[model samples]
Target: MDDRPNPIDRNLLGIYLNDHLAGATLGVDRARTLADAESERDPALADAVRPIAEEIAEDRAELLKIMRRLEVPVRRYKIVAGRLAERAGRLKANGRLVSRSPLSPMLELELLRLGVEGKAAGWRTLRRLADADTRLDPGQLDNLLERAHRQLDTLEQLRLRQVSTTFQESGDRPVHQESHA
Candidate 1:
């Protein structure tokens, strides 16, 4: 039996993989930036985020390996555009001009969490394809999917932690809340 994907299927797969690759690139860049920026001011957040950033980069590398296995050509322009978009995202106002806003960390964590969710979806899609595609390893996809789930859980914990840091006062009351009790 011929194990190769048909030409049309291969072409479509190439496009899909490249799109996800672009997103992965952006995710890696954003995760790294967030980790580095948080290092000094929020050492605990930095500690929590640094490993996730590393895993994100590793996941991007894994995607590249998967694309190579599937014979999908990397779209260099898409990668470049993804990087540029990540940089552009930094320009959005977080209610501060020069100094880093308290909201920045929380918002960045939320964005990273969303990216991981997308990545997990991609892993699931590939896992589904693995049943028919010999070039795709089900074991590898399973591992990647599991790691993505773990990353999602970690990001959520970090993001929720950021909520109080960003919005609450030293007394544990929300910044905007008035005394009622």
Candidate 2:
């Protein structure tokens, strides 16, 4: 039996993994930011976010381990790009005075939710391929999937509450008098 692994496998996996790492990195930052911002508005929500952020960070480390096992080198450029992209996300237009804008946290929560959804799909894909590729474990992927689901739920609930309180009845503008200056 030809034991040579498919060359396509490593290339595809490396690309996907690099992208996955980007989302995980962004998710880690966004989750922590959300938790910190919510501390003033909703202490309980902030408290709930700390553990999720910690877990996601741990999962990112696990991704590095998986990449190492597959002999796939991490594209450091992608990591740098992801960091830049997240910094750009922080610069989004959010009407504000001098203090931190409410839009900041709300937009971040939405991004975090989207990132978790992406992570869930990535885990499911890995789980399906685990049988063919010995580098991955289905059980570990399942655990990640479950965690992603929980994180998604939390973000959705928080996003809705934030939307309700931040937006006006018109739902187009901030409830607070925005400084157009």
The lDDT values for all models are 0.88, 0.79
Tens-place lDDT digits, model 1, residues 73-177: 999999999999999999998888997788888999999999999999999989988877888899999999999999999999999888877887647743432
Q: Pick the candidate with the highest lDDT.
A: 1
How well does candidate 1 score on lDDT at residue 172?
78
Which regions in candidate 2 have their CA more than 4 angstroms from the true location?
1-8, 168-181
Candidate 1's TM-score: 0.88
Model 2, span 1-181: residue lDDT tens: 9775443467788899999998888778778877876776667668877888998899899888877887889898888887788778766668765666756767777788888889889889888878678778888889888988988888788888778656655467534443355
| Local distance difference test, candidate 2 | 0.79
TM-score of 2: 0.82
TM-score, one value per model: 0.88, 0.82
What's model 2's lDDT at 2?
78
Q: Tell me the lDDT of model 1 at 113.
A: 93
Model 1 regions more than 4 Å off: 1-8, 169-181
Residue clash pairs of candidate 1: none
